[model samples]
Target: MVLRTARVGLRLTRGQRNRCFGLLRAAGDVWACILEINSWRRRRGEPPVAGYQQLCRLLTESGPGTFAELDTAGARSVLRRYSDAWFCAAARRKAGHTDVRFPRRRRALMPIRWYHGTFALDGRRLRLPTAAGCPPLWVRLDRLAPYPCETIRSVTLLFDAGRLWIDITAELPVATYPAGQQPDPDRIAGVDLGIIHPYAVSTLDGAGLLVSGRAIRAEHRMHLADTKNRRKAVAGRAPKPGQRGSRRWRKTRRRARLVEARHRRRIRQAQHEAATSVIDWAVKQRVGTLSVGDPRGVLGLPAGRRHNLRLRQWQIGRSLAILHDKAALAGIRVHLVDERGTSSTCPNCRTRITKPAGRTMRCRTCLFAGHRDLAAAFTIATRTPGGVITTPAGMPAGVVTHRRAGRHLPGAGRSRRDPRRPAAPGSVGRLRPAPPPSVGSRSSIPPGMDEDPQHTTGKPGER
Candidate 1:
């Protein structure tokens, strides 16, 4: 079984919100306490405590109710988080990475987790464990958890961008299909990951698929433009380094956070949709193994500032991860292969040709031409860590499927327009007449007409 997590927002009353925040703050306090203990130890030239058992012992010795509303389970989760972070930093440092730092910074809120037995999930309501003698705390979820209740293993309470969300983790079995519907183990496909087209796929059967990311790119651009304009508008209100800002500044910051969070959510949902499309397509095509081109090697190189920002916004790592997770659940095996020469190698002539700047690649030697990403994906299919798998060198397939990701994003569909963009110069925003009132209603009278029959718009009330 594989694990998946769904983040669900919380709908809380004032008191519930306060209590939830208290729990998160208590988790933060525990984190700070751990850091303080470690700092003192470091100053004394002692090895810092980075073990869960030791931390739990320390917590027990400190007695119960040390953290307000934080139960033993929640507090232990925080301890585990700190221990994990400390060890992770230590490992990186030992591997000749000096930049990695331990968790020294304190937070006002830290996520707390509770195992299955410690929490109760009933429809939209959740019962969280609290400190001894504290009353039971029940918080409502804005929506039901996506996973089956029995499969849920844990729930994590986290605060993000001024909102409270719970991450529900569940164990799920891989997908199974009946006879003739299951993917054939011998069928293989190649995937080329790119910025414009997030997934370019080709198979030996002359079938191909391309998932466009143009909508996602537009979202990023619009959000970036909006951010620049917002910064400029707020520049005058920004306080000096030491000066305290008024309430307006805080309000502005809060709105900015909400906007940022919404952008992230939109992008995340779109990516998921894209990955789901790929998986569904593969399943329909009965593809069992996917050879994915890994482009992370060149990501570390110094690119121009503009290109670097584009790469960062591309979020290639997340894309790969989401695809992998979806593929795994669909019972498809994924393999990552070097994509260094995939683009330059010609599928038609099997000869080296300089990569083209645009989406179409031409091989002069064989007088062959085809879609660039698809050709690259086809070439990549032949290469694996074990060596090339012999297959028919095929040109770009004419029977290709086109799909668009982020179609639900702002300005993605024709029905919706991005709010970030202003109205056309000298043009007004969208305007429409209100629907006509019911035929028999007296309120349907136009503004120019009088409500009373005697006051009708006539020279002498002829009616």
Candidate 2:
């Protein structure tokens, strides 16, 4: 199915607002009840239960959280809607033999509800069904509510920053042009994932591109400082459970959550921008496929006193996942190459090099040198076109190949090589830290990596 999503702003009436709130309350109640049942199981030394259907039946029969505005029918329906994810981690814990810890419940926001249907769209307001007995409550369609589209599968209502909004996700149909037109293999781009330069870019043309998100580190530092300050202030007189609802505690909690949410929003937006930019360039260059470095291995490194502060700011794997999805849509291919020794191995001589200085990688064996990240990207981009990065589950057939070369941080050498590292055939050695290139050095592009005129290939796997 081809799904597309569009956000349509709403103009809601007061009654509609109340109804929306009622719907949210109902959803929250369902989640709370699920959590409560799991908590009961925990206390009884029994395994927690998964699924919200049973709970939905119970809630429907019990007639809970159904106010005048949030009528019984709307409440039950809303409860049933978001039930798939109700148990989540609790269910995992139950299956894994882990003890379940009950979550605290918050007071319900009253009089809100949501309706899904062939909601009649009349200008800004959407008309949806309500309880049979009561007159329908019309909500003021505002920034929070948007007219639902046929393309969307579901809409999630979120209350944040003292306001309510709906997050709509639509499944978009993949764009198809012609078969046999795979991206050009010659103009490949090597991308180095990093904290400072979130994207270290080097195309087959030897041009360098740096997409940086340095402000993220600073924001994280501020958050850390604020967290510490709050921690120290509460150290001497940590409040009990009931006392947590104190004004000061509530204020601090809200502030902390706001800061965290802001950080996440910024990081997510940055990743989207970076991924879009890279994908656009690849499509334009008609690069046949991409060999991206997998840097998530850096996450397991100890968060000790010597930790790299830069590591905490970015999620390289997440960015790559977004890139991969977009590349598929653009009909560009990506390969995950083994990142082992990618930064350390000389691109020219294939000799392992020890990184000796800041942001610089030098080949001790052949004296070949380059910035560390670009070298890894180049190495990945230069791999034989057919190579695939093997994962624990053997490579699935029919997807485009993207090399998976991972970076080795400055302090990572003392530990033994991780067995789970990507298994690429070329250069098997220790990875070394490489310095970031000076702002404007001419980056060397890998051979056979360039954008050529489109050569039609087979159609992408059907949805």
Native-structure RMSD, model 2 = 12.2
**Candidate topping TM-score:** 1
Question: lDDT of each model, Cα atoms only?
Answer: 0.82, 0.53
Model 1: residues with Cα > 4 Å off, grouped in runs: 389-391, 396-398, 414-463
Clash list (residue pairs), candidate 1? none
Lowest lDDT block of 10, candidate 1: 454-463
Instruction: List model 2 lDDT by residue over 248-267, tens digit each.
Output: 76776677787677656655
Clashes of 2: 53
Error of 1 at 133 (Å): 0.6
